[model samples]
Target: MLMNTPKSLPVKVCKIESDARNTAVWVKHIQNDFEIIWILEGTGLHTINGEQYSLSQNAVYVALPGDYHELLINPGAQGYIVRFDTSRPDQVDSDYHTINESWLYYYFSKTPVLRLDAGKHDKMKNLIMLMEQESAAYSSLHSEINSKCLQLFQLYLRQHIELLSNPSCTYKMNSLLKQYFWLVEKDFKTQKNVEYYARELNVSANYLNHMIKRASGYPASYHIRQRLFQEARKKAQYAGFSMKEIAYYLNFTDISHFSKFFKSMCGISFSEYKREELKRAV
Candidate 1:
């Protein structure tokens, strides 16, 4: 289940170290703020911006604004969800060298999940815990601590630049998937063809499909459809547009075509999915 919480703070920390209620089943949507999820224990799957990352102990997942992501955790999980606004200097210092001057955000934006060993994970968790305590006080010192802790976190990430950034096998496949995902996010609404993506990547459709499947365990077509479905689901649940208007906005030929695709991807009609979500919200 999903829970709605107040977003008044510059930095908010929710701990799941002892209780399951702290973790929420996040639905697919474009992120509106920065979120750092540090898993101290548990296993699950995290899908972010059309890529999937296996979740294990000490795995950290970062979600930036404009990225589509969903989190599914197995029962008995433990973690911390750290959310902070980028625009607020108190929460995240814009002048931080490790974050902006060193171009660490590029690496994070390209690949957001990082795997750490036990010792390093504990170090990162300590910072998160400090932020949590400071957030409770909401004093001037809290802002300073937030800046220092965030900068320290990014510095740590810069130290392990090559080791944990991609988490994939080869550099070549990682590069291909990154470009492919970027293109899909940019044009999934109007261009749903795998061949179009392949052409843009300067590879043949078959080779693109093969590499994507070998890396992500899903074909190029599946990723394309996943992106489309993500946007469709987000609109159906949150947008004010009618079904027909949504179809037109998504570049569907008509509502009929959109309805069929929605059913095939979602396993139910659009209205049915909305009703189920509404009941859960209540």
Candidate 2:
């Protein structure tokens, strides 16, 4: 059961479970805050942003504001859900603010879920259990402990990305890539050039491109273009803005440039893509 959290508190953590086999409740929930779901033991179907994924043990999902998610767990399934409002700068702790700049949060906007190995699973499980316990009791130190635990959780995820995600990636390369990705994410809209990001990362454009290409099988420019394309697709699919407005929203100089870029990246015109998506929806 989820705990009753005071509205004033910026962070809340609680345990979650599936109901009886015959009466399980699965409801679509909109993410209005930053949320993390850690499934300790569960076989379920998780629908996130209209895409369905199989939910298994040691699976973790991060949901940003505006994401649509729903979970249907089988009988006896258990998990933990943590919700924190980072929108309120003053209410959120400094540790959480640090996490906002972390690679885990940067990755969340792209890859929402990660499957943990046994050792990582146990470590996160213990941290989550401790958070649950702290959340259960109201104390003067409760908020501090919870904030510190959240920091540890972020550290673990960031460390996992560095140490486990790619075995061949060296520490220096991993650190550089993290900085590079973060920079691109921060400035992709206004600065779409790979040289700009390379400059910000303090590495030569060719070396940066080489390392990023080696790691992701795409050059640095590909990431920037992909990020812009992703935003364009999202706006086209969901927003009420027209192509011209979307072009302006993405800081494009003109509609024709936006259209050409869209066609090149998607292999279809913007209008054609939208029409196909509409037909599929219907």
Candidate 3:
């Protein structure tokens, strides 16, 4: 289950129009914040978490915190992109809070892409334009207005998400897995044990392992380790921190142990991984 915490919502909006002068080609990176990409025109390919998605006009894609995405836009592909930090707040409206929590725990956990109808697309586009204006105005109430706009945008997304969700699926199992993944997304950097997660979920370790394996085809520990490896690999490739510093930041006991773990899981040394990543960027 997702936690309810009050926090300020920080939102940033921008418009991208891909044409002769400005076409993005193979832009790939991991984001530290939540991102929503609303495609307005043309076609492209958007790959996230190693999954390729065909991007047509009106196709929306979301990248949650720690997700890696690549966008290669064809000429004339236009869209609005919104980035927001999902830091928990001290307080928020009960209804909005519930929706937000559900979104984090359920909707996004299911899929990163949502194709909107014309009406929904226009509504989202208008809201995003308003948010861009408010953000640029920098008035005394700019932050408040932007927050409200973002909440409205999220509500629209929630409605479509609910409509699109499959009712025939095993909801109980889905909920269990969503809760497990949510916990891993939040704590994987610091905690790496399946037992800890099982305890938090109020189930025995064996049962938790069984359920996760049954649902996802991987043991519960696999998800935890995958999350850790994702972060470690991203940091190793992109961040300026040294390997020792990266290991310490990720709560590893020492540099040697971290190196061994990385090689065992990833089949490459830290230096080799960085070298390959840099070459790919070029």
**lDDT of each candidate versus the true structure:** 0.70, 0.73, 0.71
**Highest-TM-score candidate:** 2
Candidate 3 residue lDDT tens string, 42-90? 7778877656788877778887676677877778777787876656443
Q: Which scores higher on lDDT, 1 or 3?
A: 3
lDDT of 2 at 151: 77
How are the candidates ranked when ordered by lDDT, highest leading?
2, 3, 1
Q: lDDT at 266 for candidate 3?
A: 89
Each model's Cα RMSD: 8.3, 3.8, 6.5
TM-score of 1: 0.54
Clashes per candidate (backbone, < 3 Å): 0, 0, 5
Which regions of candidate 2 are displaced past 4 Å? Answer: 4-10, 21-34, 64-76, 84-102, 105-111, 136-144, 158-164, 170-174
Question: What are the per-residue Cα lDDT tens digits for candidate 1 across 111-186?
Answer: 7877676667667878877877877767767777766887677666655654643655322235567667656655
Cα lDDT for residue 214, candidate 1: 78
Model 3, residue 247: distance off in Å is 1.5
The regions of model 3 sitting more than 4 angstroms off are 1-9, 17-20, 23-30, 43-55, 67-76, 91-178
